[model samples]
Target: MIKELVAGVVATTWKRLHGPAQWRILWLKHATFMIGVTGVVLDDHDRVLLLKHRFWKDCPWGTPSGYIERGETIEAGFAREVAEETGLTVGQVAIHKINSGFRLRMEVSVIGRLIGAAEPQVDGVEVTEARFFRRDELPDGLRASQREVILAAGATS
Candidate 1:
């Protein structure tokens, strides 16, 4: 039901944007909608991987995440984000949930398995620190939504 509603809204908006010259201007003005992806990776010890983002000051520790690039599948994008942020290769990702933001941003969360026994490392730019933590030992300042996603992912796994 919710998916259909969202699809209908997007389709209607796209169709409405194809009208006259004034409406074309409206379309040009509304740019930069983003689809983001998050991965919940658990090690053999049931520890979850998290990255301390260098950019997000208030909420630093959260699931590895980034924007989905054009022409990239959501699972591929999630794998890319995890690798770029933590240097950990993803095995298989199972999508768990999707949440839309108040603005034009949408986030898809997934539970992913790591490929090998690689340790976490930072990219030194987007992510400053990467580490695995037990659920009770998760660090402070995680985003509320991301915390929920992590819990959901853990539950599914």
Candidate 2:
């Protein structure tokens, strides 16, 4: 029994020492300052660019999202995330909506038009596929919130 207790303690200590686990613990213990940005890119046909996430196997379809880097405005972060994920430079980004909740969250939806008819080159590790989909024909794998956002953006595009 004592041996088992010692092993458990060691395992707990090792997890605490790991980077991501430590960050999660600190975030839970103290108020976390988690900030994220999402980009909405519209094509000439009004189709919206969507990213299929590689990590979220349970919910594989998600928007192009990333945490805002230090000293980065939400707009800059949004633009950078879009370019990084889809290889498209966004121009004339406007904050269409904001969604904030319990985790110091900021969901800033910005609208931008695709500069050219180039295919998206998936560059981010989180993104497995990047494609444009009509609002009405969005893939069933997308999260409900993401589908809603795409539909709303399409209507206004």
Report how far residue 126 has shifted in candidate 1, in Å.
Answer: 1.4
Q: Judged by lDDT against the true structure, how good is candidate 2?
A: 0.77
Clashes (N, CA, C under 3 Å) per candidate? 0, 0
Model 1 CA deviation exceeding 4 Å by range: 1-32
Q: Which residue pairs of candidate 2 clash?
A: none
Q: Model 1: per-residue lDDT, tens digit, 35-142?
A: 988878988876899888888878888888889998898999999888877788997788888887548888888888888999988768888888889899988888
Tens-digit lDDT track of model 2 for 1-157: 9999999998889776979877777778887576767767888788888888888868777777888898887778887888888888767667677788756666666676777788899956779898888777777777666676776776777
lDDT of each: 0.83, 0.77
Candidate 2, residue 12: Cα displacement in angstroms equals 47
For model 2 the local lDDT of residue 23 reads 76
Residue pairs in collision within model 1: none
